[model samples]
Target: MKRINTWLISTWAAIIGYFQFFPQDLNNLWQAMPDDIKASLPPYVAKGVAFALFCAMLIGRSVNTHKEKKVLEQKVEDTKDDAAA
Candidate 1:
């Protein structure tokens, strides 16, 4: 269980770190867009969209981590209470 947990954490970290480049990747994808499609959207829209997606990714991870930590904390408190009782 410990090894599996360690592996999961390492993989998760790698995934989160790679997401930091999402905006750059988005820019590259925008460059590859056909002219007609590009013309349909405003230039600044990409920046705004990139900001939102990246921010969501960051916040999502934090929220998930905190939720998990909270759950563990609750479980610990329950165990302590049981032991006291």
Candidate 2:
């Protein structure tokens, strides 16, 4: 129940809600791309790629947040050790 986990979960939930409610928005975005690009990727394939990218983004954010928290914790521990010396 870490704060970061909760935030990430809510954010992902919101994103899913948005797409569920406005699926056409995603299609609009897809259609706005160059015709050549659209031709390169069919709608289903494009959607899969977009989903994968979103998942990758979520994973990257989670890793970065945890790394930052770890570094901060390490800094605090070092400070404590230094103070005790």
Candidate 3:
């Protein structure tokens, strides 16, 4: 699970970095997309969709990290109780 999370985060970070560093290339790719596909949605709608996806990824990462932290805390508490006994 940790490996999967690391891989996903790295992949997304790379993609974002690529777009940030090479915006013209990204723009070219977007412009090269089929006219009908582009026409199906407004530009702002596409941007919104991208933003929503990024937000979902961030939220998912946060949730997973929280779960792991809680599990670790529970383990520590159990260990302490065992030692005290």
TM per candidate comes to 0.58, 0.61, 0.67
Per-residue C-alpha lDDT of model 3 across residues 4-44, encoded as one tens digit per residue: 87787678767766777887876787788899988896755
Better of 1 and 2 by lDDT: 2
> Once model 3 is optimally superposed onto the true structure by TM-score, how far is the C-alpha of residue 1 displaced, in angstroms?
2.4
Tens-digit per-residue lDDT, 1-85, candidate 1: 4466556556655654654556576567778989998999986786666556656656766787789899999999999999999
Pairs that collide, model 2: none
Better of 1 and 2 by TM-score: 2
List residue ranges in candidate 1 displaced over 4 A.
1-31
**Per-residue lDDT of candidate 2, residues 1-85 (tens digit):** 4676668667866776687689898788888999998888788775576567668867877898889999999999999999999
- For model 3, what is the C-alpha lDDT against the true structure? 0.78
Q: What order do you get sorting by TM-score, best first?
A: 3, 2, 1
Superposition error at 47 for model 2 (Å): 1.6
Best by TM-score: 3
TM-score, model 2 to reference: 0.61
Every candidate's lDDT: 0.71, 0.79, 0.78
lDDT of 1: 0.71
lDDT of 1 at 85: 100
Off by over 4 Å in 2: 1-19, 22-32
